[model samples]
Target: MANFTELINKHIIVIGGGAAGFFAAINAAEMHPGIKVTILEKSNKLLAKVRISGGGRCNVTNHCFEINELVKNYPRGSKELKQVFSRFNVSDTIAWFKKRGVDLKTEPDNRMFPDADSSETIIDCFMYQVKKNNIAIKLNEEVLNIIRNPKPETQNPKLEVQTTRESYSADAVICSSGGHNNAKNYNFIQKTGHTISELIPSLFTINLPGNNIKELMGLSVQNATVRVEKTKHQYTGPVLITHWGLSGPAVLKLSAFAAKDFFDRDYNANILINWTGDLNSELVSSELTSWMKEKSLIVNTPLYEIPKRLWAFLVDKADIPDNKPWNELSKKHLNKLAQVLTNDSYNMKGKTTFKEEFVTSGGVNLKEIDFKTMQSKIMPNLYFCGEVLDVDGITGGFNFQNAWSTAFVAASSV
Candidate 1:
C-alpha cells in the first residue's frame, strides 16, 4: 500500500515510543494512509513518564494563546520553540485533541487535563488512533545504528535502522529519541552522531541539611519570597517546609530555571527566605514592635502571629532569649531577631528529584532542526522531537506541550 519508489515498499520508522514518537507515528499514518508506520521503542513499555506525570493525572497542555507567552515557560530552547509554537500552538492542540474525542479541562493555573482526570484517557486516545490507522508499535527493539544510502542530486533518501533483533529500512526516519539521563530508553539514539548537551538533573527540590526547620514539616505559608544565596533570582509564591526541606510552587519554579546552575555547582546552594515577601523593613519593624508588649512572653512563647512552632524555631535561629519582655529587649537583639525572621537563611546540601516526572534540559542543539517541520536543516529525510532537543519546561503541562507541538510539525511536513 506504500510507495515503493523505484525500489521496494514505503515505510516510515519512528524512533522512541514516548509522546512525540507516538503522536508522530499515529498522525503520519492517519495522514498518508499509503505509507506503513512503525514505532520502535527501546524498552518494553511506552509512555513511562506520561503514566506518572502530574501524579498520573497527566497535565496534557497549558492554555496560552500567544506564542511568545507560551515559549517563556521553557528555560532552555526558548528562542527555537518560539518558532515551533508558531506552527502548532496551544489552541491548535486543544482543537486537535477535542476533535479526536478527548475533551480537556483547564484549571486556574492554565494546566489542561482530560475531563476524566486520568492519564488512561490520554493513552487510550492515542492508542485508539493508532489502532484505527494501523500503526505498528514495536517494543524491546533498540536501535543500535542508522544507515542511510547517500542519495544523488534529486533522489528520495532511504534510511535503514539496525536494531539488536533486525534491521528495517524506511523512506524516512523520525528521530524522536528521548534524553540521555533516561537510562533505559534513550541511550541508543545518542550513538547516531548527534551532540548531547551536558546531561544534568533538572526540576528537582532542594534538601536542606543540618537545618532544624525539619521540625516544621508540612507547614505551608502562602505569599512568601525565597531567595538563593548571592543570586538576584528570588522566587515568589507559596512555600512549604517539608521533612526534607522547602517545596511548593515557588521553589519548584526556581529549581527549574536554575537547574543547570545547581548542577554545575554540584547541587550546593543556600536559600534565604523572607517569611513575608515584599514587606518593607519599616513595616516589619513596626509589627514586631507592636507585638512586643502585648503579652507576657514565656521561655518558648512567640510574640508574633506566625505559626507558634515556626516562631519558636525562628527565635532559636535568632539566638535570642524568648522570656525577655519587649521593653527589656536590647536594640542589638531586635535587629538580630528581625533579620532572622525577615530574611532567614538555609543551606542546601543536595537536590531532590520530582520522583515521578524527571526530565533533563540538555539535548541536541535546536539550531540544526527546521522549526517549521521539525526536520533536520542539516540533513533531509531526518527529523527530531521530544526531549532529545534542548527543550524542557517547568512541571505542569508545558513538557507535553512541546511533545505535541514538535510532532505536529513533523507530521505536517514529513
Candidate 2:
C-alpha cells in the first residue's frame, strides 16, 4: 500500500464521460487535491445521458431517504446496494450538488431534478466542476484495453490504459463506462479477465402492434395494476398509453423486473391490466352493484375515478351498449363489466426503449465487486461503478441514484 506522501502525485484515470464517469472524476479530484485525474470518453459528447435524462430535466437522484426503501427501487443489485447506499446515498448526492451551487427540486413522484428544470443545468455544473478541479477530459479517445502491471509487495499495482489514440499509465483506474446493449462493446473489459453478465434491456415500453389500444394513445391511467400473464411480475402505478404501447412508471417497472422473462419469451406475451389499482373482480363487482340503482346511462357514470374515455372504452369492451341504463343491466352484462374493469388484457408483441435514456439490466457481475469500496474484487486498483456494473434500477431517477452512489464510492476508494 502506498503511503499518503507517495500518493500525492498519483494519477487516476476514469474511463467513460457519462454520469458515473463525471461524478467519479469530479469527486476523486475534489477529495484528493494533489492527485492528477483524467477522463477518457469514446464519444465526442460529454454527459450525453445527462443532457437528455428526465426528458431534458436530468433527474439527479430520488427523494427516498430510507436506505432499505431506496434499495427496493433497484431490480438488480438490490442486496449489494443496501450497503453501498449507506456510504453515499440520495442525501449525499443532493448535498454534493447543493454545495456546488446546484439546488435540486423533488417532483410529486419523488424524482429529484435541478431547480432549473433543464439538463443543461447538470451539464453546466459538471463542466464547471471539471474546470475548477483542473481535471483533463479527452473526447473521442476510446479505451481499447487496460493492462495491469505487477508490482512489489511494498507498492500498489499500476495500470496501463490503452486508448485508441495513446496509452497512459495511472496509479488507479475507475471504470464508469456506462451500460452497453451490445455484448461486443464490453470486449475491452472482458480481455482483462473480468466476467460480464448477460446484457439485457430494461426500462422499456411494451409494444402492442395491431392492438386497438394504440388508438387511445396519449390516454393515461393514474393508478393501474399491470401484470404479465402466467407470471408473477406485476406493478401498480400510473400507466401511459403511448402510440407505441404502454409506458409510464408502472409499465417501466414491470419491464425492468421482467426483463429476463420478456427476453425469454421473445417479447411476446399477454399483459393484464387492473384499471382499478388494487381492486379485484369481487370488489369491482361489488362496486358495480351499487351503481345499478342509478337510472343514468352506464357510460355516463364512470366508476373508480377512472378517466371518462378509458371507462367508455372498457364499457365498449364489455359489450355494454352506450345507451344502456345501469339499472337495466343483466347479470351477464354486470359480470363482463366487472371482469373488463378489473382485468383488461392486451397482447404485447415487442418493446420500445427510450433511446436517449436507455438502461440495461446487466454488466460486470456484482459478486466480483466490493460495494463498500466499489473496487473490482478480481483486479487490483481497478474499480467499477455506474451502469457498467450489473446494477440497474427502474425509471424515475433510481438509475441515476445508483450511478451517483457507486461513483462516489469508487472515487472515495480510488
Candidate 3:
C-alpha cells in the first residue's frame, strides 16, 4: 500500500544522529508525510551524548520562559539566537516533548528533565517517532564529500553526498555535523562556501596545581564569588574543590564567558576567590571582632556559615595557633585571619574538560546562514542546526535548549 513514486519525489537528508539531527529528521518527516527522510550518522551509536548528559537524566531544556533573558546564557550566537529562539523557544520545547508523552520536570536551578528522570525515556520517544514516521536511519556512513548540483537556473537545486560506503543524492540537505575541533572535518561544509570559525573549549574547569585547597577535595561553598584577576570576568554561585582544582557552576560559567581570554593566557593566571559571599571587608572585620569578644576560644568557634574544618584550616594557614583565646589574639593575627577569610587567591596552571559536556565555542560562521529559515544565505536548500553553527551555552541545560530551539526551527522551515 506504499506509494513508491510519491516517496521518490522528494528526499531530505539529515547529517548527524545527535539530538539536533534526530529532532530535525523526525519533525521534517512528520510535517511532510510524502517526502522521504533519512538520517546518516558516522558513528554506530545514536544520541550517545544524550545518554551521558545530566548523568543519564537527559536535560531537555531550561525552565526559562522569557525570550530576552534566555539569550543571555549563550556565549556565542547570542544575537543570532535571540531571533531564532523567538520562533521556537523553551515553552515550545516543553510542549513538543509533552505532546509526545514525555513529561519534563524542572529542577530548583531550572534544568528541565523528563519526569521519569531517565535518558532512555527521551531516546525511546525519538525512536518510536522515527519508526512511526518511516524515517530511514543509516549508521557508520561517514560522509567524505558533498557536491552541489551546478544548475543555478533550475527550479530546484539538488545535492550529492558521498560516503565511505555509498552515495546518496537529495533535493535538500541539513548539516548538523557537530562541533569538531579538527579543521579538516569541515572540508565538506567548506565546499559549500561556508567559513569556519576558530574553535575553542568552553564550559571547562580550571586546574590549580600545588594548592593545598585540594586537601579539601569534596568541600563545597554554596555561594562564593570568583574573579579572574586583571579582567572584568566574575561569577557567584556554588564552588566545589576537586582533587585537581575547582569545579562547579560558578567556575564553569566564568570559564565559558572568558574562554578566549583563558586560552590567550595559556591557562596561567591568578584567580581571587571570596570565600564569604559578601565581600564587605568592614562588615567582616566587625563580625570577627564580635565573635572574638563573645567566644572564649577563637579557634574552637568558627564564625559565619563556613564549615568548621575549612575554617580551622584557614585559621591555621593564617598563623593562628590552637587553643588561642580571643582576648589573647594579636592585632596582626586578627587582620591576617580576616584577610585570609575573605580574600583567598589561587594559581591556575591549566584547565580540564567539564566532564562529558565538552562544548566548543566556534563553528560555521553565523553570517552565512539565514536566521529566519536556518538556510544558507549563499546556497539554497542547504540548512544548519545545533553546535555545527557558531553557538554554545554555559552549563545548567542551556546548551541543550539551544539545540532544541535551532533544530525545531530548521525542521519546520525545511
RMSD, one per candidate, in order = 3.3, 1.8, 2.9
Off by over 4 Å in 2: 1-4, 150-155
The model with the greatest TM-score is 2
Give the Å shift of residue 292 in candidate 2: 2.5
Top model by lDDT, which number?
2
Per-prediction TM-score: 0.89, 0.95, 0.93
Clash count for candidate 3 is 0
- Writing each residue's lDDT as its tens digit, candidate 3 over 289-341 gives 77665547777777766777778888898899888988778778888888887
Off by over 4 Å in 3: 1-8, 328-331
Model 2, global lDDT: 0.90
The whole-model lDDT of each prediction reads: 0.79, 0.90, 0.86
What order do you get sorting by TM-score, best first? 2, 3, 1
Please provide, for model 2 over 98-175, each residue's C-alpha lDDT reduced to its tens digit, 9 standing for 90 to 100: 999999999987889999999998899999999999999999999999988855353678899999999999989999
Residue 9, candidate 3: alpha-carbon lDDT: 80
**TM-score, structure 2 vs. true:** 0.95
